[model samples]
Target chain A: MADSDELFSGLYQAVLSGDEDGAARLATRALDSGHSALETIERALIPGIREAGDLWEEGEYFLPELVTAAQAMKAAMAVLQPVLGAEAKSLSLGRVVIATVEGDIHDIGKSLVATMLSANGFEVIDEGAGVPVSRLIERAREVDADLVCASALLTTTMPRQRELVNAVRSAGLRAKVMVGGAPVTRGWAEQIGADGHADNALSAVNVARTLVGHRAAG
Target chain B: MEGLRPKLEMFTGEEADRVIDHALGVLSKVGFLVENGDAKALLREAGIEEKGARFHPPEAAVRQALGTVPARVCLFDRDGALAADLGGDRVHFDPGSAAIHILDPGTKRRRPPVTRDLCHLAWVTQACKNIAAQSTALVPSDVPESFGDRFRLHVALLNSKKPIVTGTFGTDAFDVMKRMLVAVRGSEKALTERPLAVFDCCPTAPLTWSELTCQALVDCARSAIPAELVSMPMGGATAPVTLREMVVQHCAESLSGVLIHQLACPGAPLIWGGSPAAFDMRHGTTPMGAIETMMVDLGNAQVGKRLGLPTHAYMGMSDAKVLDWQNGMESGIGAILAALSGINMISGPGMLDFETTQSLEKLVLDDQVCGMALRLSRGISLDSAGEAVELIRELTVLGNFLGHRHTRASFRREQFLPSRLVDRATHDDWEASGGADARDRAEGEVRGILARGNPAPPADDLGRDLDELIRAEARRLGIEALPEV
Candidate 1:
């Protein structure tokens, strides 16, 4: 293989194998050899991550491998992003602000959703647990977030999810509100006027993407 | 004796010690926040440093707590008979608990279970030979939320002779339950000596002990009632994603519970127990039947055994919404794992939908599963007297033992004769019989048991006294009548 082909293949293997340092090193070497950042990302990093996702869906890889692969892609992107400039925004599906709602300290569901979202190419901002309705809306506005996801494990805290939706609406934020947790059912989401609800984390990505698509179309 | 008992170990001695060391570090460095005032005082008395509500007990204090707790806890039946020995390799099975909804056998839809539903559940649990104990399976939706726990205890006491594994909703409810226990066992002294039930007190996951649970733990310890500390750590969410990390967190949480209980009363009976499971990232459900969940149970039980304490776990349950094939597979797998692991009290059969729903049919189905698991746990006998060598020699030429007396005598002990719920008929016979699945047969069995009447209803006068107690409690709680049967 040519030197450039070998470099691309090296970057691909690094990302596929979840070697963050190697991915960053190969991306740096490729850039130093006068290779365009866009080509390196499109030809090497993206394909590697896509294959990792495929392996994950096919059960050949688990969460650890998928997470590490995502980490490796992020490492490569760190080297290429500055040079790519405006093109970096196109790589992520959408920006999401996820948090466990106020009065509820449970964050496992929210964190899982955030991880799944990030693994699927969405830029996720985890606000942590006990996030008030006002803070979620404020953060969404600050990040220009396309989706605000609120999770609550307790039945008592589920009403706070509705409050989140109302808070976004009253604040006149353009972001869509999504609610989920052990108790937050789809009917409850509709009752609270949320744009979407996901029963679990993996499907949360699809729901977020569809919400983003709807926003773009509308 | 140790060699005779079949056991499952997830961690070696060195690994278990490491996990304990890590848990001790967590207790010291990243201590839990104790919201209860009395609990804070007790921890302070036990040499736990306090920073406002946060408590960091020293490793010595935890070891002391473990030392003071009795290695064995024997629960007695309502008649003051020893029902279960929850220690060593002794294993018991109970239905899953605290379910808000009951899967209606007739309609097959989830609905709020009434007091009658709880009674029926207790009755069916009593009928199951393999179900060693009963539980407060359903929170009777008809009762006031304040009195639900007490009412569940009342119904279980009236309907079942077996000792119950139950929990309280609040401190006040715990007091009421203690009174109900007193009513059943005749007096507070008798109740304490031969406790008819064990209270399952849960600490909030990720090392947080809430005020209510802390209060319940203290009460159980003080009253000499066996307290089963259920520290449910959801892996990958509230706890570490790795099973080992989750086990470490579970150790910390359960160790904290032991500290509180022992501080309340030294030499008290405390169970090292939990219901930890991997957080299913795919659909975000904490599946009870996940193999990882069973491994956590086995691993945690091993750690508990290393400390010489009785163990408990929430296993033999499924996340499936219905009593389908998925339910059978999950429940059966969990049952076998928990039994083989020799957990003292395996409490999670008959639960579905992440343990939110209870089904009588599922309970019947799980009874069969428990029977099979128990038979397997009995292991193979090596009695030279009954080795069957002579019988085999005699039958070597004929190739038949069916006509021999040894076959007739040994079959009952050696073979697991499954119930009708487990279909063994040929395909053609099955189709001719009705083509009913396990669920269908289970539903039929549930109807038969309920229709046959409660096998052990409380006697007339005692029943009246129990009724009066419930009514008085209900009236005190500002309710008019006990939901009529």
Candidate 2:
């Protein structure tokens, strides 16, 4: 095999194995050998992350493994972004501000959705737990976010999610609002006049993409 | 005692002692936040010092609490018959409590269970022989949120005759439930003598006791009702990552509960129980079927036994959302391990999806699993003087004992006869019988049981009285009637 072919194969293997340092080194080597950054990403990094997602759906890989693989891909992206300035702008998906609503301390569901969104190439700003409605809207406006996701685990705290939607509407923010949790249902979302709802993390990514009109990259 | 009593031990003697010492150290040095003012006063009287919200109780106070708690708690049925003696190696099974949804067999969809669903659950629980007790399994979504717990208890008391394992939403609801029990048992004294239910009170994980749960604990102790302290620590989430460290945290939380219960009323019956599970990193949910969760339960049971208290643990459940092979495997493994561990009063049999959903078919299927676990716990019995040796010698020459007296006498004792739900037929026979899986057979069984109705329904006047009481409580809560399905 040629030197560039060997280098691309090495980078693929590194991302697949969730080796961050190895992925970084291989990306640097491929670039040093005069290989185009976009070609390397299209041929190696994207395919590696896609394969990892497939493994996750097949139950062969779990969240930790998927997160580490995404980290490896991000490590390589860190090395390639500056070189392909105009192409990097095209790579951006959309920005999302996610949080567990006020008076609720549970954040696992929200954090999982954020991770899945990030893995799918979205810019996720996690505001953490017990975030008030005004703060979430303020942060969404500050980041020029495309969507705001709110989660609540308890029945008493579910009304806060509806309040968040109302807050966004009253503030005249353009960001679409999505709501979810153990107690939140599609009916509740529609009743609250939110934009979208998802039952789990995997579907949350698709819902967010659809809400923002960003089709997933092949 | 006709059967063998097996025990599952996870920690050595030194290891157990070390864990207890570490728990005591946590109580004395690190302390825990007491959110209830009444609880703080009781702990202060017991020599616990308070600094802001945190209270530091010495080891001697915990030891005194342990000494005052009863070693055995006896639960009685509605007829005042002893149903379960939660002591020693005696183990019992009950369905899980507080499921939000029921997986409907007809639609195969998850929906919020109503009051009628709870009544049907009580009826099904009554029909299952292996299930020793009943629970307020589903939270009725039709009732007012404040009246959910009380309404569950009222429905259970009217529908089933077995003793119940239940809990309250807060102190006021606990008081109302006590009145309901009094109305059923005829008086407060009668109810106290033969308590028809044991209250489950939980302390927050990582050593925090909330105000409402603390108040409930104290009320249960003062009322002479048996209180089971459920300290649920989610491993790798609210608790330490390692099973051993989780066990230590469980010990500290349970120990703190005992101290508060004993301080309220010395010599009250107290049980050490928990529903701990390892948090799944992938799904972000606690998987009850994980082996590490079982290990934590076993370790906590061992520590409770060492302290000479009745033990309980949540097991015999599955994380699978449906009743498939995964459900069978996970429920079977959990049931067998909990039975072998000799944990008193194991919960979570009919639960699925990490205890969020309940299914009637799964409850019927778990009956067979519990029967098999009970059979395994029975071990081998020597019937006669030279039963084994002489029977072998006599059958050795014949090569068959179908007609022998020994065969007739010992077959029932030696072998377990499973129900129709368990497949024992040959391949062609099973195929000829429509090739139904366990779930299908269980569904049929459930329909048959529900069709027959409850064998011992409450008297008409008593039922009317109970309904009136529930309605009156709803009226007090500013609701006219419960929502109809």
Candidate 3:
């Protein structure tokens, strides 16, 4: 059997190269070799994705590379998720339920934010686009979500973001609300009683981490 | 006396008809979900049938509405002086309104704007010669949320002499706002005779008009006040994915609004205006600066012009978060395009961050951009061609036009002399003058204008009445004092 150092590095390399199959294999191997699921994720998968994020930030990597690296990280998590189970919930930065508000069909920004949160070790439940405020709150309650991220692409639909905030607060859920979109501003977010607002996907992640009191992963 | 004015047409005659045809079809088939009772009754009078909470105006209704709409809208200053003519090839500019944050010049941080910020905005706008009107640009946080709409207009009226481009947040604010305007004009009849503000009434994208905004539209039309139809269609999101289709959606929405307004009061003045953006798929943001967004705006305006109506567009703004190169490039391009298209009352200067924030410095800088754009739209003049040939012949051997009488007489008319914010100095001279960037220079300009004090405050009695109105409203909201300007 390979040493612990070799197993972690192999997993890291697989994730960095966006080799989903290799990432799953190495994760399984690490788990079988007696390393904890948390350790496998922390020591390899998180670092790999963090490096990819860094590379993207520094202009060394583009979007496609970043997305693929995230895919590989997700593959490794798929293996760790069942084994880790309830404990894996603690390993996540936070649980986020994200969606594009109802009556607005825009989804690219919300999807990007969801993918980014997932890549950064946050448990993300993406509701896709045109999700009603009630469903969003219901899902947040179901998951005991740490944050509810709502995106609205139109001035008409922005009222729904406010509705989401009101619904969450009325239900007495602990989840914080975050809103974003083309027409959304920090002021609008604050005015609507949302906990936070981000203008772009990267900022959304940062804002999410800040709201949940989580330090940057890796 | 007519110089060859430059023009930009985004649609051919047939293309415009195609857009209008589709828009009419959408109104007849897809329909708009209008929630206002008065608007519904008006549409019902115009042969529009309400089907399942949506009003579908037939083509004849749309055509009849279009025919009744005044081809021009005139705005007056607070002093009842004619300020702007929204008609044929006359372009005016106002700062984008309703931004919630102000980029504080001292800290360079964006914070919730207060009364002082709004006053400062008015002062600088008054001093900007190229900016033709004032906007209720900042939503002051100190006031109650419901009072924001009229409070902004009140502050603007007291601080600046220019006509305002403003809107209402609550349906109740409309009458209070109209009363304030009446106070300024000395009576309701005078206010109606010379409208001092153009209220923006936005229709939600994908054929929806909210109750609040629709009520504002009906109120404006019935009151004989001009309403600017701000149809905002974020392409591929609230609107169709295709650019042309986005323009079609914008027209359909605005056309439905026109039918409601004209049916309420025929011959009512309205500007077929919009704030549509091209959806940037990669970023999931509506980029106002994108060329495609400009195309949608121009195309929308082209349709308005084709129908013999005045037009407005939310152009000359940037989505950049700061006063940077991106801001300059985007704003400059939008200004030129809007001007070349001959859009009347272009409504976006001093806007940044997706129209969420306003900067005093950017306002001063965009004033120069607007000046240059207005000059560009004037095009080159063959009117001066014969005189130029004579000057050249007279100075053939001297090679010195600088000292010539013709050069001295015509230089101001021939060239657009930009402000100091535009750096045309020698590199060494620029270095000697502090080596400041555009933002730094703009900061200085804003400071200089503010230091000059309010250029056009209202008369003392009028100002007092306006203040009392706002104070009473604040008192009603359980507020004791307003922030000092």
Ranking by lDDT: 3, 1, 2
Q: Which ten residues in a row have the lowest lDDT in candidate 3 chain A?
A: A58-67
For model 1, how does the per-residue alpha-carbon lDDT over B1-485 read when each residue is reduced to its tens digit?
11265767898899999999999999988999787888888887767788666888889989988899999999888888888899987888999987999998778789999999998999999988899899998989888888888888899989999999998887788877888788887888999889888898888888888888888899999999999999999999999988998999999999999999999999988889999989999999899989998898888998898889999999999988888778888999999999998898999878998889999999988998999888878777664356567767887653344324454445666767677788975454466669998878998899999998888888787788788888888888899877764
State the lDDT of candidate 3 residue by residue for B1-485, as single tens digits: 65778999988899999999999999999999988888887777666788999888889989988999999888899888898999898999999877999888788779999988999999999988889899999999998888788788888988999999999999998988998999999887898889899899999988988999999999999989999999999988999979889989999999988988888899988999999998889999888899999999999999999999999999999988889889999999999999999999998889998889999999999999999998898888776766776767887653334324455455666777778899975454466679999899999988888898888877889889998988888787777767775
Span of ten consecutive residues with least summed lDDT in model 1 chain A = A56-65
How big a share of the true inter-chain contacts is recovered in candidate 2? 0.00
Clash pairs, candidate 2, are none
Tens-digit per-residue lDDT, A63-111, candidate 3: 4456667777888989988889788757778999999999988876677
- Expressed as tens digits, the lDDT of each residue in A1-218 for candidate 1 is 49998899899998887788899999999999999898998889878877876775554655455556766787888898789878767777889999998899886678767866875668889998899998888899999999999999999999999888888999999999999888777678899999998875655777898999933211
Off by over 4 Å in 2: A1-218, B1-4, B483-485
Off by over 4 Å in 1: A1-218, B1-3, B384-388
Task: Write candidate 2's Cα lDDT for A49-151 as tens digits.
Answer: 7887787665566555566676678789889878987876676678999999999988777877876687667888999889998899899999998999999
Interface RMSD of candidate number 1: 25.9
Residue A57 C-alpha lDDT in model 2:
62
DockQ of 2: 0.00
DockQ score for candidate 1: 0.00
User: How close is chain B to the truth by TM-score, in each candidate?
Assistant: 0.97, 0.96, 0.98
Docking outcome class, model 3: incorrect
For model 2, the interface Cα RMSD in angstroms equals 26.9
- i-RMSD values for every candidate model: 25.9, 26.9, 26.9
